[model samples]
Target: MHRTYSLRSTRAPTASQIQNPPPPPSSTKSGRFFGRGGLGHALRRNTAGAFAPDLAKKLSQLVKMEKNVMRSLEMVAKERMDVAQQLSIWGEGCDEDVSDVTDKLGVLIYEIGELEDQYVDRYDQYRITMKSIRNIEASVQPSRDRKQKITDQIAHLKYKEPNSPKIVVLEQELVRAEAESLVAEAQLSNITREKIKAAYSYQFDALREHCEKVAIIAGYGKHLLELIDDTPVTPGETRAAYDGYEASKAIIQDCEDALTNWVSQNAAVSAKLSVRSRQLSQRRRNNIKRRSEQGVGHDLSSQDAPLNDEVSWESTGQQQDEYDDAEEEEDDETEPSKHSMLLNGDGSNGEKRGRSQEAVAA
Candidate 1:
């Protein structure tokens, strides 16, 4: 049985602590509001992977125990019937054989009753724990969402404007805040999930164990019942039957109390793990995003080379461009003049073309 927990030192949270406590839940809307994917998208995430294997194992074991109990119950019932027949024979005062079956039958019945009571009580307790877990899961959802948005916005801003140290500091604060929120959400989720598993596990184990015990007792009682049926009733047989009845009555009544309460501290352990792990995962993502944004920001903010170097390159390029432009203009001017000269060649300028020119001149 675990003891209850009490916090040590009853001081209220300081302003700094509250401010720095945690990050928000990573909801898409909140992420977007905080510039994470919007809350709608965030809801779509982290829904699965919650039901782990340990829970399955516990449930499987419970099933096996139940099977054993059923088989045992059947065998015990048949044996009880045989015992009845023997009791009738004994009244006839005939053959000599085994002891009376009444006591054994009584014991078996008592055990069954006890097992049933345990079932009811244990289930009630489990229901209570489940309720608590659900309540906690619900309570934290809103806060978790709000925090996610802040973290996202901070990250987005940091990514967009990397040049400012003040912004950097502000981004860091947001990241820190988001980290805290992630932790809280994870812790809450883990607690709820783990508690549910444990509750089911406990119920299953208890039921299985009790049923197994019952089955065994029933089998033994059946064997005794068989023995009595084979035996002839005599004076001694009367005493045996009476004793069997009383014992069964007591055992059956007590079986109701067979259930044990395990006030779990498992919830706390799970909560701690959940909160820490969740926060850690988120922080890792945030760090990666932050570094990338910072790198990009740094690149953007880096100073350009001196203005003198820029001016020199510009001047050189302009000079080359001017030279090319002049050369092109000169070529254009020469093309037209060359064509006109060919077309209007005078005899003196082109003595060989005089014949062609005279023909055209005429």
Candidate 2:
């Protein structure tokens, strides 16, 4: 015993059978029986000999037809399977893209934060430099004023310093004034006034350079973010890509939809094939029954009843119902539930699959 529908023929078609082929059996509305008139006509119209060669030719043609339909069904099932494989590959690719973009966004965020910290740090440095410059000026201003006053007083004392007591005291006061001026100069040197001036120039240059560099990088990153946000995603708009992230996402969704539809279509065709197999079984049985009633005991057991012992006709309807139930259950559990026609294998973004949670999180 083998599968219920075996299109194999024991004998090859003769040249006469090829030239004048008989008609195949017609299916009935009940789906279990064939059109009696068609089968009986094929069997009775032959008058060549005792052996119904014409009837045999008709049965061969029927088998050929079944084989052709079965081949077509198998081809469709294969196509549907190819679509599923492509869907899985496309989905994994999209996941990679989403992950890549997510990583890039994270890097951008971290870089921006570093730039902000640099900006604050640079500003603090600039502020401290300015404060040191102000403090140095405040410390040196009084000494500079005092030195100018002593020069003026010594000019007047030089004219009266020979013998008068007031002249001697004024001269001594002038000497003390000169020494105080020298002391103030030494104190100013201790403060490293020249070094502070040099620091002012160099620090400002370094800070400006650092700040400008950080600003440029931060600006560039911000511009990139804006571009991503501003890109038009609506259909019928311009096409673009940010490292192909958006395009890949759209493709993944389209593939998912196509796979779902193809799978559903495969299920439908499988059901049809099952029905067709049953029809072929019933037609063969009818022919055998008629032959037996006429006392022509032609053996069709090998051709008609070749299914596995575990398989029974009683469960055919139940099996189909179960297949349909399983299909519905699978649709509920998977993501591509919405119905769609698989027009082509190309993953075109002509339609939108609703935003997925993973896409949103990324």
Which candidate has the highest TM-score of all? 1
Give the runs in model 1 whose Cα sits over 4 Å from its true position.
1-107, 148-177, 189-197, 228-362
Judged by whole-model lDDT over C-alpha atoms, candidate 1 comes out at 0.39
Candidate 2 lDDT tens digits, 240-275: 433645443343333223322322112221223588
List model 1 lDDT by residue over 101-127, tens digit each.
Answer: 333243344335434433444444454
lDDT of 1 at 117: 34
Taken over the whole model, the C-alpha lDDT of each candidate is: 0.39, 0.36
Worst 10 residues of 1 by lDDT: 353-362
TM-score of each: 0.31, 0.28
lDDT accuracy of residue 64 in candidate 1: 26
